[model samples]
Target chain A: SQTIHQWPATLVQPVGSPLSLECTVEGTSNPNLYWYRQAAGRGLQLLFYSVGIGQISSEVPQNLSASRPQDRQFILSSKKLLLSDSGFYLCAWDIGTGGTETQYFGPGTRLLVL
Target chain B: GQQVMQIPQYQHVQEGEDFTTYCNSSTTLSNIQWYKQRPGGHPVFLIQLVKSGEVKKQKRLTFQFGEAKKNSSLHITATQTTDVGTYFCAAPYGNNRLAFGKGNQVVVIP
Candidate 1:
């Protein structure tokens, strides 16, 4: 069975603080990774997705960036957080095949930028 | 990037009532996947629909893929409080990437 894990389940940081959220997947290799943000009562917004190590696709232009250092390790980072950055950050993975992707998400991290 | 548009972004259903949410795409789709996310939780994959005009069911939930392959629908029967969550439909965009619908937030009233 494959499982996804995320860290800092809950985070509270002052404005202009740096941000680092980590996600790791077990039982899978070369999986496609994605980062999403959901605002309060809003829809899931795709922030970044990585096809392979060091290959990232940005969906939204913002202060946040994503990195895939290892095959199954993905990191979402921000140099300086903005108030608008407060939201639920989720990490997901897919098999990346057949031109069809079914995503499995992690526990996610709730961020509050004050 | 392809965008899947879902209708009735918010749904308020009375217990035991039946309701449906729709997802549409301007271009034909090879497949579509559904997911459910509970309050304060991450999204979980529900099911995937392929083959034009396909229909699949899971207990009280029925999923349909349009014959044109450009639309999908999820129908839930006998709504329960356990069904309260946001339902999102997604389809492949670019190589191995999926574009998710805005989601239909189902609020079940007991």
Candidate 2:
């Protein structure tokens, strides 16, 4: 079966510090990858999605950016973190297209910016 | 941008009582997907609904896609404490990205 992995599990950072969160998927190739953030007790906000290697689509223009270096490796990064950037970050992958498609998610990483 | 809206930001119910959450979309969706997120966990895909007036059930949970294909609902019979979590309905925005609602947080008091 396919599985997704995300790291640092939890992170604490100071303001203006750089941020890097990694996500990797096994058992799938050319899968659609997405980056999402959820504030405390709030809905998820889509930050970025990549269709293929080196192709990313930004949903919300913010301090954060996303890149798919390899087919199954996606990275979410920020040059400088803001207090508002603190949240539960998630990485998801979908097998194919359309609104009806199902998405599998990773365990997620909780980041707190001080 | 397509907008997805869910009703009752929060629902509190006693265990064994029924629970339901509704999702509406600004535009006609080709399909809708449901996800459940535990208190401290990531969102997990529950089910997907396609076709107008489609009805699907998984054990005690019943999912319905509106005849107009613009809304959906998730109904759980005999709610359990394990059902406590945020239920989000997501739909594709264009071709790839999905737009999620604020989600309805279900709290089951056992």
Candidate 3:
């Protein structure tokens, strides 16, 4: 069974602070990883995705960036956070091959910027 | 960029009633996938449709992909209180990226 993990489960930060959210997957290797954000009562927005280590694609470029340091470890970071940057952050992984495209999501990290 | 539009932004129904959410795409899709997100939780993969006009069912849930391969729908029969959540239709945008719709938030009153 494959599982995704993300942390810290919740965070409160002042404006203009740095941000670091981590995601790691187990039971899979070379899977496609993605980062998504959802605002309260709003839909999801694709932030970044990586097919492999050191490869990241930005969907809606803004104040955030993502990195794949290892085969199953992905990190979302920001040098400075904006008020609008606060949201429910999720990490997902998919087979990306073998004719399957279903994505598995993590527990998610909720960030509140004040 | 591929755009996915889902309708019935929100819905409230009796626990035994039926509900459906539709999704349309600006461009043709190789495949479409459905996801459900419980309130305050992350999105979970529900199902996927590929072949044109394909239909699949899971228990009381039915999923359909349009003949044009540009639209899809998810229908729930005799909805349960546990069905309360936001349903989203997503399509592959590019290489390995997925574009998700705004989602249809369903509320079931018991």
lDDT of 2 by residue, A1-114 (tens): 999999989999999999999999999888999999999999999888998999999987799989998999999999999999999999999977734479899999999999
2 or 3: which has the higher DockQ? 2
Clashes of each: 0, 0, 0
The global Cα lDDT (0 to 1) of model 3 is 0.91
**Fraction of the reference Cα-Cα interface contacts (below 8 Å) that each candidate reproduces:** 0.72, 0.89, 0.59
Query: CA lDDT of each candidate?
Result: 0.93, 0.93, 0.91
Misplaced by over 4 Å in model 3 are A97-100
Model 1 ranges off by over 4 Å = none
Give i-RMS (Å) per prediction: 1.8, 1.3, 2.5
lDDT of 1: 0.93
True A-B contacts kept by model 2: 0.89
lDDT of 2 by residue, B1-110 (tens): 88899999899999999988999986898889999999999999999988999999999999999999999999999998999999999998876888999999999898
Q: Each model's TM-score? A: 0.97, 0.98, 0.96
Give, for candidate 2 chain B, the lowest lDDT window spanning 10 residues.
Answer: B90-99
Q: What does the lDDT read for residue B87 in candidate 3? A: 97
Residue B23 of model 3: what lDDT? 99
